[model samples]
Target: MFKIISALTLFISVSVHAQTPDSLLKPSPIKTLTTQQYNALIKGEDQYGMGLVAELNGLPSPDRALKYKKELDLSPTQVATFTKLAVELKRKKIEMGNFIVTNETKLETMFRTKKLNESDLIFYTNRYGLYQGELRNAILQASLKTWQLLSPQQVNKLLTFKKS
Candidate 1:
């Protein structure tokens, strides 16, 4: 009976630990993002609130452009264009995020399993740079497209809205 209770306790402890997020176990100022937040990150949403690209270019992101649709007084053509840009950005973000995550996982697994090789490491690391560059390009391209579509006045008006 004691042995049975001990085994059951061990099983419950393992199950509980397995269900816990690794982030919660770590010591950090930013611990335990919710599931939705993590999923959004995976989906390529800028959960970290980094706006270096958009700020540097003086361009709003697609979703931001759409948010002030009325204030911007976007034409039908503009609406369609911005909508398309948003959709494309979303698709690209998801695609890039998946590639990064998969490669990161593979790289870690290789190290953990003692299968890592120098050439493969260099290739994967460089591949990560490419992924980051591509993702940045996609984001910048969308902003550029948005900027091109908007009139000077419209752009200035968008600049007035604080980021939500």
Candidate 2:
């Protein structure tokens, strides 16, 4: 009876941990923000989307920075660099957001005109493609910069922490 109880408890513990958002294989922040807040932020501009794009591309958040600063054994010097990197990323995000707004006006013009047909639809879709491509490239740049800022050993530690 003791053996059976212990085995079951171990299995349950492992299962619960596996389901956690910080699981090693998951690269994204799993925290959920309320839909109302998300909608409010995204309504006027695509800057919010740019931020998400950066995150999806592995640009670490401030929260992630705090987690890694301790885990990676970063010095004061590195922390300062990381803060600068984050600021650069924010600027890139804003640029992408502005690009989206510029494209949006063109898209809206096509949308409002009765001239919209198959070709117009194709053109409209292309605008979104361009915006997404630009956004993704900006994110990639930030991710690469962040990677350069950290040592391999620190990255390995991050992986281990995620697994734990």
Candidate 3:
């Protein structure tokens, strides 16, 4: 009887533990933005995770352009051009980021309040996508402008600089 009771207690404990909900499986109250996503949005950083696609494809990001300006032997005009592009990119990215985050909050509210409908859903999704594209375009266009500012030799050097 003692052994049976001990085994039953152990089984019950194990069953209870197994039935406990995992924190990972539990839904967040916000339901949309993870903590990191929220931080990036609030800080006006790239939340789309595609900010470096241009750099990965042999184009220089604005910071990178500025970083290697002297090494790339950039002309004063090129430096000025990259600076202007960087300023514009930062401005546009912040604007678009705010737009994206606002739309995302609306999306979260719709789903959270059980007010989501097909039309509203489609509208927010499309709006979010449009803003995402604009943000990416802003970054990529800056990269392209930076690339154009560099000479062919400078571009080649920038492209291969990482390997060495």
| Candidate 2 residue-wise lDDT, 81-123, digit = tens | 7777667655655665555555555566666665568876787
- For model 1, what is the error of residue 104's alpha carbon versus the real structure, in angstroms, after optimal superposition? 0.5
What digit string (tens of lDDT, one per residue) describes model 3 on residues 83-112? 888888878877886787789889988887
How many Å off is the CA of 64 in candidate 1? 1.0
Candidate whose lDDT is highest: 1
In candidate 3, which residue pairs clash? none
Estimated TM-score for each candidate: 0.74, 0.52, 0.74
- Residue 102 displacement (Å), model 1: 0.6
Q: What lDDT does the true structure give each of the candidates?
A: 0.78, 0.59, 0.78
- How high is the lDDT of residue 160 in model 1? 85
Task: Please give the TM-score that candidate 1 achieves against the real structure.
Answer: 0.74
Per-candidate clash tally? 0, 0, 0
Question: What ranking emerges by lDDT with the best candidate at the front?
Answer: 1, 3, 2
